[model samples]
Target: MTAPTTSRAARAALVLALLVTGLSMRTAVTSVGAVLDDLQDDLHASGGAAGLITTMPVLCFAAFGAATPRLARALGPHRLLVVALAVTTVGLATRPFAGGVALFVVVSTAALAGSAVSNVLMPSLVKLHFPDRIGTMTALYTTALAVGVTAAAGLTVPIGEAGDGWRQGLAAWAVVSAVAVVPWLPTVAADRRARATTLAGPVAPTGPDAAGSAAPPARAVPMSALLRSRTAWALTVFFGTQSMQAYITFGWFARFLTDHGIESGTAGAMLAVLTALSIPVSLVVPRIPARHHRAVVGLFVVCLATAYVLMAAAPRPTAWIWVVLAGVGGGSFPLLLTLLGMRARTADTIATLSAFVQAIGYLIAGTGPLLFGALYGVTGSWALPIAVLFTALGVMTVASRRSTTPRFVDDELAASPR
Candidate 1:
């Protein structure tokens, strides 16, 4: 039997749900970075501990990404998202009330995990629900995510100054998550009804040429197969290295600027600009076809390289030019995510690739901030660390070129016929 088709109304509802979900998940991670200094002073925390607050959310992305497929398999994607949102609410609510370092860590980690699962599952949702509009919707959702991160990062300082304390400032983002749930609830309900009516009996087994096949055998495309693919490795490495660079800027660029004699507020505003400027690029780039992927990737690398050189060598006025260049270069993120969706042969394949790529990739990426910090601590200068970033970007250039080709999923499917 054919599966039930979604109505236009259902499709619209899914789009809205995804937008809000993306916004809320980003706010959870970005808000704390904006108010880090206030939180540190208020809680009497050390620099390393404050850094952990920022790092925790990213680490959670890798840690919890591995579980998203299992959760989706058991609960269905819509229901799993609701659970993730609920967990996010609990995590945000408890953060303000945490009495000590231990409690803060626990609550923060919980929040991060929720955000992580949402991040991993969202691309698949986009692929499943809006395959025709993948380019457009991917652009929109990614732009929303960039906007959310920028707003939270820019507003956290002002919000903390407005009232209660840093705790309240950090906790305020729960409201966004709560509002996101309104549209999602109906989607979840509809999904449950759909599942109950459709899957009333055991699934049929497929020998060959079975259109009803639920999924392929695990052995068909083992982890070893993915590991052996150069394209897959290049994609993974490209994603990992760019992510590391992004986090390094996100987590420490403000501090780096402040240490170099810029005022704290100015540094923070610049950081906000860096994140905010990417929104337009992210919204526009994914709508274009794969033919221009290599050119775009090469342009991003050049922008990043130019940004690093100016940042290290130039004086004040020209420095911000490089900053803007760096922001525009970071547009590669949405491009990569869109490529991931377009590269997968099936939903199950997307899930497996996402888990493997993100889990190992993010863990490798997670070391950037710590390594940058350690390098600075030892050398007592930004020059060497900036060089390190340039080197990473160089590697990113080559890896991105390999990933820009559009033939991986096709090759895999052709190799392993049904």
Candidate 2:
């Protein structure tokens, strides 16, 4: 789809709309952790069942992300975004009404399916509208994402305590989800008009420059072909591995800190700190030149690896130190988001790559926390899980280096079928 033209005022409005949307993306996933114990008590959910609240983000992200590009193809990006937000609002609002584990899981899965679409397509939106401000806009929305996680994690428990309890906490985020859908209505109208205005000229029957040829440049590439790119594989490895480690940390770190003698309130706050500290890094990292991402991201990965080592060895007295280290490392989140936009030259390529990276990448990520918890169940220690996290971080470092190599994903797609 062609980029929509806008005046400065309209562009700023669109940016604000995006900021609001970004705030809703992680709320459904991160808020669950704060009230997980309470839900287990109230709903009588097993540890495994309660855990689905956290795991659903990665799973729905993979599942929903796999379908987002086609929706975006059939409906333009702006309209698909509006559609996703409306569905998210429903999912978020309906989830709090569940009286049992099964219903809650179903609603949350629905909510997160919408979440998945937003997460995968957001980078393409930034590239489509703010191509000149890739770093700035990427950093902005990503910081909004970081803020969303911090708010949901840090506030959910307190909100639950103040009112009717866990249900209130679960329903609080739906407000934001509903509000974020408003600014895009105008843009959706613009997209429809643009689509209708495109001329469908007849094909020039048989020449070097034929009619079907003109439309080929604007058509969607076969995603099957994209999976064959070595660069695409490397990007998936990078995105998936880091996300795997993050899912584990987001899902379990609060409880891990509490087990080390930290108070439950303090423990939840530490997880918030880990996500909160990433905000500045997310805002700044994407603005820097791509030439520097290798060293910058590698350094962050090393810091993240160090946090795992510390958590494994001595998580008690130095709890604050290690968690901060983890947050600093988390700043690479924007770097990853930047690559989604920066690696593609056109909007279509950006959307396709975003879908592939989030779809395949998140499916790989969904196994992380599940297996980390499973390994702990089997080994009766955090050693193996921590070691596994460190290994994932190492693989991520290598993938980050390659995905940031200043290459276009489309170029790789054009090179061959395989």
Candidate 3:
């Protein structure tokens, strides 16, 4: 290939790397969820075992997500992602064949661990490769991520029914995970070239020209320094609250709808609508300029709070409206991904912040469904849980508004006391 065509081919490969990796990130979680009942029956698992399976995504995301930055430093982000995809493929392909629930959970955890690391790496990879088009690239990848979540949720059951069992259904996603690895192999080669470039010269690669042309610069700020940065804290809180809201909706919203007198089938459809709406919202939110992010955050807060209020006050009559509003509010996730790029200058900073934000943020998120379930169990009414979630929206709004302000975590880290 000519130099120009070779560069174009490399760029195309990187884009595919982002899109497919995002598409695979949630497949391990949602495919199992789609066939949870069948899988539980086949494995003869108890309710608690099943619950642990359902909860593993956030738990794995928190623990492994925190470890990803260090892993990336050692592996190089591109090579680490190739390893992650390999792990994902193996875990997905194997978990379905386990004879017992214990083995199933173990392999499933492996799959989620891979997905978790991939999740943390995305923002940094985008920052490294497509720095000039963060908005567009983020929109593309997150939209793909949303599609993966929706497709796995919507299709796994039918595939299960058509095949040998839930095992076949869950294992089928391994194909997609394996395909996601292809683009990254070439990208790892690019990383090698980048490292060679760094070794051959005194001047370092920086900015958009550095895309796949140099290794990410060494970290200027230690991860511990983030503890003292207000911007980092604000982003963490914002990410946590939004993630909590999303997990609660996915985990409990169907029951919440059914409890409010909607038919079970309709409630399931509404939940699908809520999940599917994230695709378009993900596409749109990133295109909004940073100048208007505060307003965008306010709009999401209003949509979410309104959805909660309507669900609490007039759920059955306005169920569709609530779904639509909540769907719009789900844009918070894509918006946060965009902010992950905006809040850091260098690829290294983005990687650090992404890890810090998603690690503790996911731990915070993991509590929402449990807390919501507990509150409802205690009160025997959705009122208490809805009210609590409404309060969380308030917190998310404050944090998101603060984090959306034009500030870099790197600058804040520099100013923080050692």
Candidate 4:
């Protein structure tokens, strides 16, 4: 069947919705990392609990990602996006009012669940709506995500200094999601109408196939199908390891610096630079020739390795350099996200792969912060924790070698049962 056609205006509006959604969702999650100390102090949270605060969104992302494909199938992707956005809005708006850690967890979990679905759906949306501009649009959306992260991480302290409660600082991001919905209203209506028509079709009794034998029942693509594909497993490992590194940095890098004798504000600024630098790096790296992409991947790994070495060896004057290296390596994130679209054979395959990869991938990824923190608690120094990061990067290097190859689509197709 030919894909459904949407007008240019509608497409533009949908893209806008995606960009704004990306920005809002990222801001909500990253802002707390920027002000972790303040939030911990204000709420009287322990280090372990503060760690959970950061990990909560990632856990929700993994949990909710599994449900997105089924939800999209039932509600239609467009309408599901509307509901997700609304949930995100409510989640963000309520953060300031939560009475304690339990309430904070509830609100934050809901918001991140919404954001998680949105993240998984975004690639398919790009494929459906802007097939011709996947690379460009991926770059844009990823850039918006980077900018949002940087803004939230960088500005939270300043905003709090300006007498806005950190709660208010964090809650303010909901307005972005609310604004993003404006451009989506018409598309949501159209999707609801289309779904209504689909449901109203003449009913045929469910029975055997045309051959007169019982029709082979449609089963979910087996989870093992993904496990058996070397490429899929490689991508999963790549995503999981890199994501672990990213979240480790997001959740603990500021505190790590502060512990190393940097002031909290300086640490936050360094984190902002690390995130902001990813915008240009993400945009530029994808445009390079595919044959040479592995070299870029190697460069990122080297940068990460060097940054970890410096962070462990020289903690003060060289901290900024380490942050820059981390930022450059962070570009791999958007690269992986873009590849999810580029590497899939069909929209159905992309949806399936997206759900599987993000769900399993993030569950693995979500452990980094807790593990690193626990290691610190035991070792009583950052050195061993930094060593663990280096090990993860080494694993990422091996996984990325396969991932950077321009053949996952072909590999997945060849591996699929005929």
Report the lDDT tens digits of candidate 2 across residue range 1-418. Answer: 4566799888888899889998999899878876877878888898778666656777788878888877787777888888888888898888877899999999888889888889878887877777777788888888888889888887887887888888898888999989999888888876687673221111111211122222234446556767777777888899999888887887778767876789988986787777788778878888888668888887897798788888988899789999999889877778888888777666666777888888899888888877888888898778887887888888898888778787666666666765
Per candidate, the number of residue pairs that clash is 0, 0, 0, 0
Clashes of 3: 0
TM-score of each: 0.88, 0.91, 0.93, 0.86
Stretches of candidate 1 off by over 4 Å are 1-4, 189-225, 410-418
Model 3 regions more than 4 Å off: 1-6, 193-220
lDDT of 3 by residue, 198-271 (tens): 11111233333233333323454456779988989999999998989988999899988887778999898999
- How does candidate 1 fare on TM-score? 0.88
Model 2 TM-score, all chains together: 0.91
| Deviation in Å, model 3, residue 48 alpha carbon | 1.0
The pairs that clash in candidate 2 are none
Q: Pick the candidate with the highest lDDT.
A: 3
Cand. 4 TM to true fold: 0.86
